[model samples]
Target: MRVLFASTRGSGHFHPLIPFIDACTARGDDVLVVAPPGLEASLAAREQPYRIGGEPPRDELTRVMKRVLELAPDEGVSLMTTEVFGRLGVAAMLPALEEVCRTWRPDLVLHEAYEFASVVAAERQGIAHARVAVSAARFSRSTDALLATVLEPYGPGITERLRTSPYLTRLPASLDPSPYAVTHRYHEPSRPGALPDRWGGSAEPLVYITLGTEAGAMPTATALYRAVLEAVSGLPVRILLTAGRGTDLRGLGPLPPHAHVEAWVPQADVLGSASLVVCHGGSGTVFGALAAGVPLVCVPLFADQPANARLVAGAGAGLAVTPTGGPADDSAVLGPDDVSRIRSAAELLLKDPSYRARAGRLADEMRATTPCRELIGTLDPHS
Candidate 1:
């Protein structure tokens, strides 16, 4: 069967589907991607071609996002749902997705969770579709309301159709915020690489730091990065920091003796032996660290990050640091106050055994979850 995959214009939206894409192609199923223009290169890097969707009105989205940054967290999030994902996203993607579905004649549409346009197109085309969660669960409290508002134009029952539709969730029940009908265990893929000679046996505890590629471009993240560097400085633990290519490190001056910096590295390779992880609470990073049984110090930057961080903290696998003083999009810097929290959190994670133990239990739960192949099989037309 021919399957069409749809995602927003970011690595977080696209990368989660990589393993599933590999699985589908291995089984000789046809696959195609419908996404925004900037993602073509990413798809090409994966040796896949894609159909381009119209770019969202960036200026208007930015204006609304600026407004979102001012409101209370919950209010901001609800506005973001209504304005950004629900309205702008649907407006940009639905036309192209509808055209693609019409021409491609896909039997199924598998889309990133926030890509609601695909569901609309799928319903309009009378094709089966599933929502693929980027993280362990849905982050926003406004999802149902947002869907209702945006899908109202599509007529009745569309919102119910979306709410009751299939979802491909990577996280287990323990970590998932909402109940999911289908679960697919997450596997962090890595390239073949040589490990350091003394990797896992190092006497000094290894701390891995990353804020994800998307965070590197944010001003708030730059402040967070500086705070992290200072917090870990002169600490006994050894640090490996992977700032993305978008982060300009030239002005950061000399690094601390305990910390080593790189533009990017294979996270799965480094995570295998990490003693602690310091990051921006991205779902992939959070899950990867937990899967490796490493405790975390999560400094959330934006979007779903704060929610993810709270989940980790609530799960007792990590500590959440709110250095921004208010909303993440505010100009609030990660000041000296944050350093103490970071250092304390890291030290506690290293000294205490409970955090690691909780992580281990979660890892085991994730391991026992069903693989994506099994879940994908449920989509088979012939089945």
Candidate 2:
């Protein structure tokens, strides 16, 4: 089979598909990756054949994203579907991606769950396709609204592609919001370098803190980072704080004596030894921490984050501390209560045994899931 995979520019979106791409190649099937121009080199480094699926012009994308971010939860999701995926996504990439499909004539098209463009193109060419989920079903609820907007061009089959397509998810059944998604065991992608020795295998409790790349870029997230720094200022634990590629460590306030700050670290490597994880509730970090049997202290910023935080709290595996105001508000400035909540959650996760036990259980569940490689057989056109 000739397989084509498409994803948005984010690493979070692209990483989930790597296992499948590798699986196809190892089986001697031809494979190619479709992504924006900036991701071309990264795909090349992974030794995957690639094609450029041109994205919306930067200025237009920025404007559309700004508008999408300002909306309330349901409204935000609807706007994201219509604006980002509809306008900036499919509308922008369709011509180029379609050209690739027409010329390459792939047997299967696999795309990031929210990147409906590839699915639409596959439908146009009558090719088999599936959605690969990088996170829980954060946007599934709004998909019907998205389908409504594109009903004329793509019709109701697009709705099936969005809502009920055969798909792969890293989240265990417990964390996955959609029952239709198949739980593919999580596999950390191979990184280029060795793990940093910042934690030092300390017997003291170890906490790993990161906001992921996108969350770290937010001004509001810096405030949360500072609060976390202050909360753990004099704690007995050894801390590994990653400021992310987009974050400047100097702007994150003074580092505590017990903390080590770095621009990046292999999260999977750090999580293996962490006693607790503090993060911005990115699905990657949430699942990473859980898979490592480390409890979490989630300070969600926006999008699916707040819900992810709540899910953690409800599952008894972690804690979620969120700003009282809406997503659009400047949540960077934390009041005393907010700081206390965050601090207390960290302290509790460090001290409590139940959180750790639940996390370990989730880890076992994740491990029990079918591996992505084994599941790739389902994508065969003959099957």
Candidate 3:
């Protein structure tokens, strides 16, 4: 069976699909990943070749907002919803998607739930398609129904039209296939050489700090980095920071002897050995941390991040922080006062064992939830 996987342009959006693609290929099925131009190079470094498309500018907020309005214009949804929609809008790469489908004529189209274009295009061609949800809770039937109702006010027939659309043919929103099946299992490996030398032979607790690939390029990235640095100051732990390309790490100004800073490092490698993770709460990062059995300190910068962070904290596996002051007291929005709060939360997780214990248990539950392979079998029984 030939499968064409369409992903959004950013690395944060594209990386999670890797394991699933590898899984399909291992089963003797041909898999082709399609994304914007420079994305293919990133995939190539991981030894995966993906077809390239037109380059989309790296305006995370603007692009995401545009996609949400395109999907459900009436809903007064937050930026979080827009971000989720934008990620899903990757399906809007119609020219590239149409080309790939015509050439490869894949037996099925598998895509991120947020990328609704694939489902529409697949429906038009009468091919089977399934969505890989980026975040938890968003895929549930209850949520879908609620979102549909919310979007109904935007356009008279939009919600009804989507309900009957070929995109969600058989399976309900909540039970879609996820690629994190194997990732939820913890497997420790030696740290990579590319990691900072200080990472070598460290007995102190390890805190993994990353804001994800795309959001890491935002203007707020530097502020968040400083907050993290301040939060971890004087702690007897090794800090490993990955400032994605285009970030100005120079402002960090001479890291502590115990801290290590780099442009990028293999996340799986770092997570495999990490004791805790401090991240921007991207779906991939959260799932990756959960898979590694590490607790999270989610600093949601925008979009679905706040929602994702709330879910993680609600699940008892982590804490959520935001940049805006809101009723959700559990989260610390970015500000002068938030620095101490962020530090306090990180310290609490480190000092208290209960947080780790709860995180570990959730990790097990996540691992046992469902396997993408089985889900794929259901999607294409003949294959």
- For residues 30-64, could you state the per-residue lDDT of candidate 3 as single tens digits? 78887766576776775445777654445865666
Write model 1 residue lDDT over 120-161, tens digit each, in one string: 888988888877777655673245656787877876788877
Candidate 3 structure, TM-score to reference: 0.76
Clashing pairs in 3: 80-303, 80-304, 88-114, 88-115, 139-174, 140-174, 322-333, 323-334
lDDT of candidate 2 over 262-310, digit per residue (tens):
8887777788778898888887888778877789989876667777888
Per-model CA lDDT versus the true structure:
0.77, 0.76, 0.63
Q: For each predicted model, how many residue pairs clash, with residues at least 3 apart or on different chains?
A: 0, 0, 8
Rank by lDDT (best first): 1, 2, 3
Top candidate (lDDT): 1
Deviation in angstroms for 136 in model 1? 4.0
lDDT of 3 at 357: 83
Off by over 4 Å in 2: 142-144, 181-195, 199-201, 325-333
Q: In what order do the candidates fall by TM-score, top score first?
A: 1, 2, 3
Clashing pairs in 1: none
